[model samples]
Target chain A: MSRLSIRSFSSSPIASKVGYSTVQPVHHLIPIKKQTLGKRFPELNIPKDDIRSPQYKPKDVYQDRVNEYYQNVLKSDLLLHYYEHDSEAVTGNKARSWGEFSPYAVYRRDRKPKGLSRATRDIKPVTPRNIPELTGISINLYNKAALEESWINISARLQLAQITNVKPKVVYNKSNVLPWKVRQGKECGCKVELEGRDMTRFLSTLVELVLPRIRTFKGIKDSSGDKSGNITFGLSPEEIKFFPEIENFQELFPNLFGFHLTFKTNAGTDERARTLLTSLGLPFYKEVKNVQ
Target chain B: MWKSGLRKYSAAASSTASAGNSTSISSTLLLTRNPVITADVSKFEAQYYKYQNELWKRLMWTFPSWFYYRKGTISEQAFRELNPGPVFNNPNIEFPRGRPVVVHQRDRRFKQELKLPKTYKEVSQEKKEGGETAAEEEGAKEDNLSRQIVPNSRITKADESKDLASLERQLSRTLYLIIQENSKWTLPTFKEEQVAQGDDTKDSSVTPLHTLAEQGLYKIGGNSINYFNVSNTPCHVHKSESTREYFIKSHILSGRFVPQSESIKFLWLTKEELGEYLEKDYYKEIEHLLSDI
Candidate 1:
């Protein structure tokens, strides 16, 4: 509740004429409340990780059929167990006390092959149904000038549609902010979501014709993931000309604007997303070393 | 046959004598019995004879007397008045001198009845009644087909999984050629002319293979000669909603791209860029061919 200071409205001449009954206090509810364990028993509240079994295996098992025979037959441990000390060696080898058993046997056993983690070992093969694919690409334009002048919003919408080859939806200001000059429900920006063939086509233009041609464009930084398989980047106002649609009718748009491009993918993890994206032909700057 | 014919001649003479004295009912009966005199006498004779030759035949077959004997042509207005009505009058109901005062409502059901069949019983009786063997056979055929389909589906699944595994290995070092159309970047594909089957091989220029080679060179440009060795068959195949596309792989024997078309630009994007740029299915088709190399 606000401090019960002198009511500013009561002092006004209009308030005296209208009477106190005309003015009513508006009730505002708080958005969030602190959590307490409600009426449930404390012991019954189990964590999700606790419920999951320790052993992990994907439903779609990726068994190496081609190397199945070799895998079953040839295990490095079976062929040779290089122990560190004399006591650690096998009975026959230890009795012989031969130095050539393994000159490099400094440790108990050599490490497994590079990508042989438990997670990778138990991976399920990807099917056509579960294949990681591009969902859609969204172009978002935040027209800061629109807040000051309303007419700019209309031109921004037209600009986005012309460049993206689809009609854009007008984004409105959600809240009233006097300082920023934004009014509630006023059109402030425009966005377009491209899917299916259009998404692919737009992506093709950005990756090939537009992004690479930009002088300052040095591939997407490794840190640019949304942590949810979606990668987003921005282009400058000048880069808009690289789009063939925009390039063809350069006279139409005298004042070009830049926009944010978001690539949505079905890969569950950022790593899978990165892999899926890498295959599509986008370059990642920092991940180059890691990928190699 | 001769005796009966003579008896009939004597009877006709007596019937003439009787008709001369007083017109008798016997003569009227004879008129009805004679095939030429009555309209349905031939139909009655057919019931007994049942054979073509046995049935009495008219010596001269002509149109009805009313047609030629009428005052005008058959369809003329006056001809309708001249045409004869039924020979016997109905004793039960007398024809009114003028239009009858009583008006009866015409039954609409009669017209509707004409559209329906007279009897529906015979139709169902004619339907062939067979055994369940056909149904059993059909079920067995379906079972066989389903059985055949099961293994095919499994084989395809296995093949896809195997393909995925091999794709991962191949992805590390694949070189992609992206061709630009309008503003969009897509995989570089040579559009081959769809040739009709079994055409003459004399014109090597028109063959699909040759056409692909020519277009491939044009799209690839003359600059890739140093490092790239373009292959004969495509490593990845994609089909858009409109056209069939294939992604061909070549070893990067050594050089960079030299743009060929003014509007149709070209770019050498990494696998990740290709994945992001191309259509989902298009990228997926060549996804296996991509790797970190």
Candidate 2:
């Protein structure tokens, strides 16, 4: 058990706390000892050759159907593969319904086309169960200077996000999600382990969850730990029951969800990232804001 | 219908360079994660291999540990020790056993090594310390170029001239023109206007599916289906009333993205919304199951 040192490949040091992404078998399996993300991507700052810029040429109008055919028939590799089955009752239930929200493909396409592999047909779609839920939380700053000092906040969240089983997806959007209609209850559809299930439970759970966890735990600086300070963990609805607020909203949100808690400190960077993290009630970090 | 078309394009691409190497260039021919090809691939096998390798090359960005991260089972005791917390309400939910979370792995390293470029800091430091630009760097280490590559999203691009509304309009119009040319949709405004007084019957000519496809907003009989993929399998059901109707129904019914067929029949769905559905496949069972009662 050697300490994981996360340093950028650059001659300049890239230090961050260590963490792992846990997925069910057939996906993310961590080794006994893990290397830091920075080490894995030493070339983070470098530019590469053959980075083809997409030439987005508008195809012929009549080609729309052909394009549509490609989109539907040719599924993207990013699609979470799932095995779908149902009793006709479930099928009938499904039949009775129309449009769905998440873009999970019914039939998972192969990573590559036929011919390249010995048996392309042998490849099966991963069952819905196989897909891991990831939770993302973004912290945007009202102040430009705060946002610019990224490592201060990014490192903190990264450490918390990496505690163990929990997987974190981070983004820097002025707003947390796509500029579309927000969902009703759940935080995210990410296939990652979460802290609390909802807003209320999150507060209590954080004290419980992170308190026991120790790693020479310090806030932004080594001297100032979260002894009297606050740190945020973006939460989902299913995790809310663990919150102290659950008693009030129990009936409303039976399914506990995770909440986004912003760590507040009088520290230079705390106030900014905290304000941003706390406002994120649900676990959302994919959306990058369109600010000037 | 698309098979011949794709094969044709692949063949054309095959002709440009040595068929051996051409496949390496346009390698990311659209595909799913399984990386399995299903169609006839005898003629373009080289191209297919290039596509496969290319896809693996790209995925390295998102999940670096895809290759070489061995998954193992953590015993219940080990699991508890690692996650000394309360049990989840869902009993079936079991966490992974062996691997602690490590973000980067061999594959990601491979990619990093593939796309390295000198940073301004590096250039500046070198200049201060006595050095030259990329040409000098290039002459010394060509392979090092791919070492520390960062994706575009990480780099802030200053260009966003297209506003949301404008982008939306452009997208919608793009969809409109596409549907018109591909489908048997006939526009009457150009054919004959009332003011032209040419022919009332001719001006009225329209594809039957136009009404359904044109509107683009339909609530699944019970769900909100974002998109619909028209299957032209028994021949790409392009143009013709029944095909259009079938295409609409295909979006509503059968297959992985099959939505609640009930509400989708006449659900209030819009064209732009449908474009999203077309762009991405919706996972029905898992996501929909979490819906609020």
Candidate 3:
């Protein structure tokens, strides 16, 4: 193992602004000359730039690396599809076409040349402007009445970033809750809304690896879905540990907290949303019957 | 620094007190916050039923069929000329106003294809150079040949005496195609699979039932085919022919069966249906192993 770098703590004595004395226990009472501790141990001296310069933090560095990975590796034909009209966003659209996995399902709709005497203004089967599909995933981390430590919020943000493979934004309280000691604009937790390929990939991992490994999980409850079709589920701290990314590196996260995961589907009804989720291999359980 | 230590101790005590107070407060706060977790059940019921009622109303609205119109009408004449009521144009025959069907349509205009993840074979081939050296080429060829246990040429020779030996052993595990000949249902009869004498039989280590099952006997055009065995193992093997012929029971996991030959008119019937439809002699012969027909 490498020896501890003295430069890291060379300036610590100066920071204390007080010297320890064995001969004179009451050094504060006795007059003494200021000591240059660095002169005695030159190896302990760190460069001025190293001590005072503002540098990118470890989380920032990791976030940059993740962004690079998302751009170079994850953003490909297997994930993102580029439109022909918007070429710059697409970047040579023909090169990275969806190929066999194109989302648009086409059908030949033969319409007789329409005129003033057309039977109906609308086309057959009603060609939709957009298809019903998974739009995004919203993950909310709720920290109950704990807003004092910025480090906890930062760690939670980093944890979410690590799990989602995307940077998370810290959420602040919109209104003050006097009893809970929550003040308006105080950072409480973090959230991440993933869309496009990232959304699908995160969902796939949750369905295939994460949920199956969780012992206490009994599938998404039937009553969990909102009236508008979005389904929400809660994971306990123990269940969060089952995520393969976190499970493999337990030491990195000392206090892993759970979050509420919401799947935002374009399917208008709960039944269609359930069907879509089922197709993605997420099992749904029937509501438990209540005793009379 | 000595004075700061005393200050830090006091700060820590205050922080712990606050933490304890917050925890207790939040617990009580949760009772009021319960509304945030639970959803409105009656609202969901209203929304779900509203969608269902709309779907039911849509289902009642039928498409205007050209056949229902008068023969002299323009719609009927156009329908006859165009013939646009789900022929080869719409092979799936999905109802126009029904549930949305998702299809994967390949865009031929896209010429530049992105690289897919390489397989082990491809990685090895790249390491050896693009020419595909003799050893690797032979290995690939062997793999391809092995995957096809029964060659197309041997499909006709499936009923030979040499092949029948293994079929009789695995009779309870194979699926036999029952055909309707002159309105009388009976199991499909196989002819001999032709092979040249001393024709590389050394390479083939497959049983007759596996070989027969893989063949395109009841051909499914273009669609991929797969087979899986039924799990109801019979106590006794059923054989109709005195020559000791036997067949295994299996199901088509995927693919639709279209007849390769005009003479092959088949139906997938249950054991009881087969018992009712087939001749008494045929049904009686296979009665013991008719749990899954």
Candidate 4:
């Protein structure tokens, strides 16, 4: 907010060169709203995470067992497991840049990376510093029935909040489809992004209490993941009932909602992310394809 | 990085270097029993957590009783009976300290406390009802989910008696398996059988470091140990003039490590405890590999 001092950039050579008129470019990378840029609003100036700020919330309320296990045990084990002697970082195929001083190449985007349409992340050898750890978990509940009855999404949101202990944000439809009777901006679902203690708590509950109770759960499919360290798997409404929060209160939650859980990690690849998750007690099974 | 330096002196290269005087290659099992319970925190940490937990509870929203316990239901009546409503703020009464700001049956200033009706009657309650036989019958139904959850004590019988050989001794620490051979306590190290030199047909007999460790473990421990090998690769290597010991990292998942031979005495101990038993210089070389927890 007002903590950042405003400086005149008109005098600088770079600013002068890019200047179209008398007005100078803003020096700040992030544009501050005019209403929040004054000393009168002292509360706005304080960071949201600071104790003095109104938005401050205590996170580490107790010793997180799941996170502690990862730190003390899984970390070193993973580092040693992934260790490779004389292994070098395998750089990803990056987008090719046009030759310098080419008139046609000016203001043009670079060509797509080799083989892959998009650039993939470089595979670095695992070390003590860069050992993969669960960063966050994003649970998204898509209520297709809400497309017709918007109020139905309320139950989904409430269901998510009850299980996660965090209020979910309502997700809206982006496009209209006449065939499906879907309209743009319709409240179709809800999502909650969990981190820190809440994330670990959810992870422990899922692994220890819920997953084992599920009858048909072989394991998470080996193929599930975004290839970029985020592994996503969906729980059926029947499977979701295994959660202790909903199990004892089946009468209260008459209509249960299923959700997709995406485990976000800094492992950089799906394979490593899967390994990290497996080490944390969530099992994975190889998906067998039927041969005709 | 040290692994790379040791890679040059691998068993394959070293065996070929000095055909006559080949250095003995051995596999050292770095078997560990991971902490079953959360690590014990310091006084400062415990206090900080308690303070934060209290703050969190104070800031928490009132539990939605209406949602869980619908009005007019038998369960709702039981819940109401268990958790009586807080003191109401009457405008007619004069306030001395402060008027209680009651909202949703909770005082806004204080942390809300609620109790649900117990699924099973307590043993003392049953005794008051003159049902001595019922209390004895309830003791047999320990696995009943309706019974109140009582967590097991963190300190096991092994800990109380200071039995280092038991896996349950230290529930909150990483325990390593060390054996006593020739009256010297050290990590379980197994040496490869020296094959005859210049035997071209028996080249395939050379076992991988991890395989050697597994074979050695079953040989001494009677194959009862159900362990998970972290990887095929060796985690660490200890170099000596006469022998090269490759550390094969593994975790004992279940089962007991029974000593097949009476001469070999083994103990599962924590990092600090191992330092006392192991040779000072030998422990110092591999201290970084052990987990502090």
Candidate 1 or 2, higher lDDT? Answer: 1
- lDDT score for residue A279 of model 4: 83
lDDT of each: 0.46, 0.28, 0.47, 0.81
- Encode model 3's per-residue lDDT on A57-91: one tens digit a residue: 11211112223322322222112111121122111
Give candidate 2 regions above 4 Å deviation. A1-292, B1-205, B208-252, B255-293
Instruction: Give the per-residue lDDT digits (tens) of candidate 3, residues B215-261.
Output: 42433222353444421111123343222233434445455455565
Give fnat for candidates 1, 2 and onward, in order.
0.00, 0.00, 0.00, 0.53
Q: What share of the true interface contacts does candidate 2 keep?
A: 0.00
True contacts kept of 4: 0.53
Give me the runs in candidate 1 sitting further than 4 Å from their true place.
Answer: A1-128, A287-292, B1-293
Candidate 4 overall lDDT versus native: 0.81
Candidates 1 and 2 compared: the better one by DockQ is 2
lDDT of 1 at B258: 59
- DockQ for each candidate? 0.00, 0.01, 0.01, 0.26
| Candidate 2 chain A weakest ten by summed lDDT | A87-96
Compose the digit string of candidate 1's lDDT tens values, residues A87-187: 22111111222244677765445444444322221222233344456677888998888888877776677678656756688789999889889899888
Winning candidate number (lDDT): 4
Specify the CAPRI tier of model 3: incorrect
Candidates by TM-score, descending order: 4, 3, 1, 2
Quality of candidate 4 docking, DockQ? 0.26
Best candidate according to TM-score: 4
Poorly placed runs, candidate 4 (over 4 Å) = A1-38, A41-44, A98-103, B1-13, B17-22, B118-145, B200-202
Q: Write the per-residue lDDT of candidate 4 for residues B24-142, one digit (tens) a residue.
A: 88889999999999999999999999998987776665566766677788987989989999879989999897998665677766778888554345644756587568566577567
